[model samples]
Target: MTTENRAGGAPAPAGAAASSAFRQPKAVWAVAFACVISFMGIGLVDPILPSLAGKLQASPSQVELLFTSYLVVTAVAMLVTGWVSSRIGAKHTLIAGLVLIVVFSATAGMSGGIGQIIGFRAGWGLGNALFIATSLAVIVGSASGGFAGAIVLYETALGVGIACGPLLGGLLGNVSWRGPFFGVSVLMLIALVATMILVEPTPRPEHRSSISEPIKALRHRNLSLTSVTGLLYNWGFFTILGYAPFLMDLSPLRLGAVFCGWGVLVAIFAIFGAPWLKARFGTARTLYGNMALMAVVSLVIGVFPDNRTAVIVATITSGIFIGNNNTLVTTAVMSIAPVPRPVASATYGFVRFIGGGLAPYAAGKLVEHYNAHVPFIIGAVTVAAAGVVLSTVHRALDAADQEQAHAGHSAQRADAEATA
Candidate 1:
């Protein structure tokens, strides 16, 4: 947060030095600006799609691929970028991602053919993947006391970007469908400049491995299940984002309201719910509880798309799970790992992007073959399985924590005896 090493010796008391995220300063704002720029791209495109098609004289279906291509590109980027970041450090990755965003977003604005547009869109995804995976890593690393408060603020920033997308998209889309993305291009350029000049290079430990440590970290039980579940949950999560409009074709107003309203609820509750629910249920239980709700909502929505009221209710209910699931799983990953917070956070992010990318394509297939509803069933079932995996991972973490605590106490006693 301070972008300075408080660990060696700062004038602050031990507790103040420890609680840096609470007072993190300019570095926090710099990272937050990066988040807003990244999310604006992801969230803004939907509102402008119709206008984009009209400008290009493309069909409605063709415009849909913009969303698909973006997700797929971002997913692949996220998975590989982690390995790359682990090698170079988080700051380099963040700056590189911002550069990618600037380049691709500009190209997207200038795209001529359908293929050109898709290519540029895909490029933006790659940039986003980099921004996300590494920005998260840096935030955790710089989060003095650790991930606790840092994650809360990070998610809040994400939620704000997502919430503003439709409003920004609609306003800009009216000016020109291409206008919103060009707006994104401008935003990225700012972020690119800020990141290079403002974001402090994350200090890596001298003992940090060269190229493959993150891969080894991935094999840890807590990391593995958390990563896997993150993927499944996001897979289901993005499906709702991808297909809600189609499901609500009976009412245009309802569709718009549902998507926008969900964002509102998530922003309001993500930080607040963590304390109330997390303390009672614990991380694994809270994560599972959200997944269970996701499954139920998917089923209920899939079954009865006719009732607009039920659909909206389902929409808002699902929003409650969005940020808290993030908080729960991310916190769990750190708690489970002996390696350190940054390592676990980055690893969880990489695999989760894999899930986010693939889910849309898979859901498209299900919708093509069976019913429009089939994807929901498949995603739900998969997420439930992920919940089970997380539960098992939690048991492993509890056992490990007990062992570490015992070892620490034994060491303290031995030190006392030696001194006496």
Candidate 2:
């Protein structure tokens, strides 16, 4: 449970005995703020989507596309953000993403139609993909050791932003649909300034020859399994969060309370559950177990929809697994390629982004054509497939790791014999 800093051969300070958690790095706080801002945009519409539908003459399908389009763009862009970061560095990416977010957010506020608004949302995603991937690099690069905790904390805090969005949006909905965007834009501007001032530029590693190398490395068990796992969780995670409000419009309690409940579960469990699961089971076991847990809950929701109580419970419980999904994925990618963890993280993000991108769009269409229930069904199937992919990848990676260990021992023995 303890880590030694490779820098000076010293044990890391215990988390419980930390003089302060806030002093790790200025970039840590900046990245945290950036996460808050990115996630705020996600949650900002939950309270108001139905209302926006009414005013914009948008159908449920149309409204959901807002999220779908953004995710698609983000997924596609995430592939290269790490490469771009390698060229320009994390600090530059963070600053640039912030600027684009600010401009696009302002444009979103002024958008005259649903199409324009969706386009603006896509712009935010473009900026956001760069911002998020780079910010992650910044946080990881900041630490001497023990960056995993910080990564989990970042994901957990994002749950808070998602949680707060509906409540804040609900309160502000009466003002205008534009109110949340404008307000979030203001907050983003502050984060941008704070990030620009506080985040020191770090040295960029030389571009690795042939970006294809990272993609090739992903065939290893860890990265491949985690990416599949991430995609599965995201597909289901959005199935619940992105579509729940629309689904809950069918219930008596309405969508606001449902989103609040879902968000709360994600935040609470992400903050508390992630570290416990990772520590107790070890990353691979936790990653494997949670996929099963998620699949069960998602199926339960699909099967028992008439019982609103069961549906709510199933939806919220899923968040517990989601809390750790990103961490598992990020950590696994790191093991796959320790030297260029940023590139590994991006590749994982990109793969999952593809899944997340499709979820909303596919779910929306399914809701329009088949029924609202169809989204969850497909999501459950996707998660099961993810389980298969993860299992295969994990087995493969463990074998490779063991092989490398044996090779290392052989090399050491030969060297010692030669010296003797």
Candidate 3:
């Protein structure tokens, strides 16, 4: 319920807090389990990109549209997730997302051509928008640990799901690319049941958010800056994620193994490395350094596209930095924004996802028109630009972090005095 900070805007060492931070009620774990599956959707199709291209008779650019269609729809629909959840309640919204994913994923598997599968993926994206928008709010509201702990739990699931997605896709793609789709359907169905049985229904908020509210939240300066930074970072992030698979020339299984290793690093860094680094370096410094490092990594991948081993190592290496960015940026968004959490989340999601959706599609075009290296070169430049953007907001970001620590410290003191 309360927290204290040491020097330089860091929370007091989490030693005393760590034990209880991870302990959660069964309901929390159930939602977390579902979250793992939900996030797996991000990378679930990665290992099958080549297979899909071959079987569907689609070009690399067409295959890349799979990412484009899904993420574009998801980004556009993010604006309404808060509005929809406020009316329907979180449980039903989550179930609706699950149902859509199941139906669309299965339909994608059965589709006759690339066009049909791409269309079906759009529908799946809408489901993802609803689920992802609400899942964080639900977990934060229900979890036993403090806000930091809940974030850790959520990021942990993200790391695991992302790590496992390629592995599952690889294994299933070995049988048939269709296998991954059916597998997600079955896994999500189980997650759906667990959510229904274990997670309690969330009551609607007192003042329901309007569709316009998330858009309005962007009027705040800090929120906009953070969102723009996210957009640029995402451009680089997805460039590698969306385009690199084609260059590997490995089997689906081998590709999965590489990303799986990447995912494991993502998990480890998000949980342990991020907090530790932020505590020592602070958010602004850490982000600047990390983004710069990512730029170099992306360039390495681009410069040596034909070097299988370098590309592979860089791919896995990028995960550590990506994991750090995911946690820190999410925290920064929550802290810096003055609007309600749901609205802030929706707004932030809307802005950043545009870059995420566009980058992969553009990467495909770049490869078609130019060389394989152009996308990564462009990705590196944009990522470096994001670090500069974040630097411009350094003062406000530091103030927000300090205020959060002060507020938490005051609460802890109040509790101590009352008990005494």
Candidate 4:
């Protein structure tokens, strides 16, 4: 990919000036649609968490292993995605990922015990790691609306998937906890078929990426700092995502509705709110403020874990902060990292997902040993610390913004010359 494409620079010549983010080639839409289903896996189990615990005769910690197995495996598997995708190409990798998800999700649905489901989820995570990393790069490379637009499109898919996952889970889980699993299996099968048909085959990279490249890329100060901050932020993000349903004490359907509301806000802010905030406040200020606000929200959850209304309101409100952070942080990683976009994505995913994977299980354990308040309190501290870590990179953020502006201006000049 060109530097402009990788860094969210200028739009490609095909539709440089006229391309709206919403106007994309059929292939871009195909990957994006797959992204929606892939992301649904993150929250598809939320409404069913309580149900799973009871049905499987498992403790909260044992049930939380579903997330632990999936995410932790995903995090580790991120290391090899670039290696795998480079050799076989993006399209095959995506198909491989989708197939794993379909098979494992179906098996998970048939599982009679929590341990069996957790094992299957780990397999699902491996596929997720491959699909998630490659999809972002494919979208960025093929999208019409420039790098910024591509990121927005991707985040929109993420937000939509997250929002719909719980709603679908609740709607289906109302009948049986296994319904959501089968639902994912069926939806992904369709996505796999669509991908095979719509997305053009990608050529293998001239040079294969080594597994160590992502870890080596982390030696760069800006990328590592940004990734570490992400790790801290996710610790708080998943704590609520994983553990808060128990506190809500609502039925599966109602719990899904609550998270669906949260996911809606996540989508809205990521698409619309993030751009406005970044333009007005600048990326650093926007991220700092956003992270601090999320910290406050986590603290609120900590304070009133038992107050259903307070927990619900605070949980939903955190989505706004989460959405803004997701867009801005991802943009920052793409722009500031010195390595290739794929490498940066892999490194960032490797580090951040570890936190996301672990936080929920930790929260569950903390609740078992201490009280509900303790985990959220810890979550608040970590989020606040993320803001502090981010402050160290103000210069990097400014430089990235300036570089993107320069590229945008240059692209406009080129477009004018071509027209003339």
Candidate 5:
């Protein structure tokens, strides 16, 4: 793939005025705002996990189901997102997702039982499935400066949302566990309104993808390798997100603060650090080093679960690697897969989410059966395995990164010549 295609499949013709990636149309900004809110939903509940467990008389395992239901549903639902968006259009698909999130999040806030909240979260997940899968395509299709700029913008939204979600959750969760849920409902409602008003309807693709296309895309080895690497890495990622709270005996506000710090690092690394590293070290080498560091960090968390300061430091530090890894992996998947971009995205989402959906619940079970430390140990091991998995696909990833680097140099040389 060329550097332009690696950016997110949107490319500009040669010598076209390279517009500033930051300067975007009203529609792009609107969708980006919505993307921020949508992603916030992922970490919004972090501060409230302990609160929910205590209030509902549920166990850690039960509370962890909130992630499982949401992610599992989102994973399965990803299979049909391309089909739905193709038929109804991107604007409508986004609207439907926002509506579902608004309703179900509010309903979850009112739930009398953990079971009820879990069920509502599943509904929310279905909506997320549609919105997330289509949002990238919409951004790529609509934005200026080609695919790279759009993707950076998209990743920026993701980073900002993730960073803020915990802070919002913490502040509201201090009042009540339900506060975060209601908060998300209100915020997403606003996002929905902005989207409806600002984003023009997206044109449908000439050939709508089949429902089975994502699954079939997995037949390609590069896509499969990337997917499994993501899955294993996520096993560690969710374990930290879901289980770390139990180890921290701080108030909801304090836990939220800790995670917010983590999120800040994540956003910074994803938007700035990831690209810098990839440009300097190459994608495969960067990933190898970062994944190894993550394994060490997870092991530290596992070994020092009772050391409050150590745990907090490790947790926040983990965000750096997570953020870098997320950007690199997503970009790599988009670039390396031979299938259509939408199909590749859907297929990648479907496969990786399996690890994300299952990991947290498994973390809970491991804690119940073994100990808190044991779960982190497992998390460490799994993340290490992700690095090993990436090694198998090293040739493909390296080639893609090398091409991108060369293309970037060529572009720079051309610009210099033009100025001269």
Candidate 6:
């Protein structure tokens, strides 16, 4: 039950902490496994976008509504996730989320038209908001390692799910556009069962949260600034995720392969690359450099949209930066925000998902009215703007890094004493 410190009683290095991230309890793993499936919903429909447009007789903008509905609903619903979970407890909240995803995803699979599928996806978004917010709280509350380790573990699941989602979508979309939807329904059903059985019951919070708390949390400058920056970053992130497939002009299978490669880099960097870079350069500097690189990558994609090879390579390359940003920014928000974790999460989710929700549809419209290059050029600008917003909080980022390090050391000492 105790983890010893390194020689000379120094706290374990990042490598040791990372290794410990995986050595978690069954309950944690159960939730983590469910987290993987829940995250899969984000990219599960990606490979099917073009297929949906063709088969449903919908325009690309209409098809893009799939992202719009899901993410917009998710953003709005995030305000209530903490309230719901606080009243019902984390276990029931998680189950409620899983159940909704199962029902909605299955219905989406059977929908007769683009409009019907978009509606069902909106319902799916509601479930995602409830599940995603609560899962982070549960993992941070119960995981064996400290906050940093838990984040690493959580991001690992996100990376793996993202990586796998496109591949699964491709294989299934090749069969039928509905295949990915049905696949998610079945998989989420299984994850639901596992979560219900393996995860222990959790009591409701002693102080129930109001729906307004997340919004109120935003009054804190650090929380608000980070949330705004996340919004800008997501504008670029979702532009690529939502709109890039049409440009690829590949088969569903091939598009899946491309995104799967991107996801692989996302996973690798999230788990390993991010922590190493943060330790070396500090959070602000790491994010500055990473976001700049991402802006450059987006610019390349914008300039060379007609060149399939260039687009593919740049898209995949962008994943490394994306992965690093995802982990580091989330960590920074969790550490620096002067509010409870759930509230901070809900607030941040509310802001960021809005940009994500809106970007795909915007991209579609831009392409319709202007050239293919316009949306991505705009995406590159928004990401570069995110870096600028981040700079205003450089001192806060340094403080968060120091705070996390101190927390880590204190946790190690506690474990060492308990063992002795």
Total backbone collisions for each predicted model: 0, 0, 0, 0, 0, 0
Sorted by TM-score (best first), the order is 6, 4, 3, 5, 2, 1
- Write candidate 4's Cα lDDT for 191-253 as tens digits: 999999999998898889899999998888988999999999999999999999989988889
lDDT of candidate 1 over 1-420, digit per residue (tens)? 111232422222222322344466567678777887787676676555545656788654466567767877786555566567766777888888888888888888777877788889898888888888778766655655433556666776676677666556656766666676788888778877777777777654444433355567776665777788888888888776665555554322333345567776676556667545665555566777888888888777677666657756776677788867765676566555655444555567667866776665566667667666777777778778778877777775455334322322212121122111
Over 272-312, each residue of candidate 3 has an lDDT whose tens digit, in order, gives 88878777788889899899999999999889999989998
Tens digits of per-residue lDDT, candidate 6, 100-193, equal: 9999999999999999999999999999999999999888778866667788999999999999999999999999999999999999999999
Q: Rate the local accuracy (lDDT) of all candidates.
A: 0.65, 0.68, 0.82, 0.88, 0.85, 0.88
RMSD of each: 5.9, 5.4, 4.3, 4.2, 5.0, 4.0
**Candidate 5 residue pairs in clash (backbone atoms < 3 Å):** none
Residue 136 accuracy (lDDT) in model 5: 81
| Top candidate (TM-score) | 6
- The lDDT, on a scale of 0 to 1, for candidate 4 is 0.88
Misplaced by over 4 Å in model 6 are: 1-12, 407-420
Q: Kindly report which residue stretches of model 1 are placed more than 4 angstroms away from their true locations once superposed.
A: 1-22, 49-64, 79-89, 201-211, 250-257, 306-309, 397-420
Off by over 4 Å in 4: 1-19, 408-420
Report how far off residue 408 is in candidate 6 (Å).
8.5
Tens digits of per-residue lDDT for model 2 on 169-254? 66666577887778778888999999988888767765532456447646655566677777877898777666666655532224
Instruction: For candidate 1, list the clashing residue pairs, or say none.
Output: none
Cα deviation of 232 in candidate 3 (Å)? 0.6
Which of the two candidates, 5 or 6, achieves a greater TM-score against the reference?
A: 6
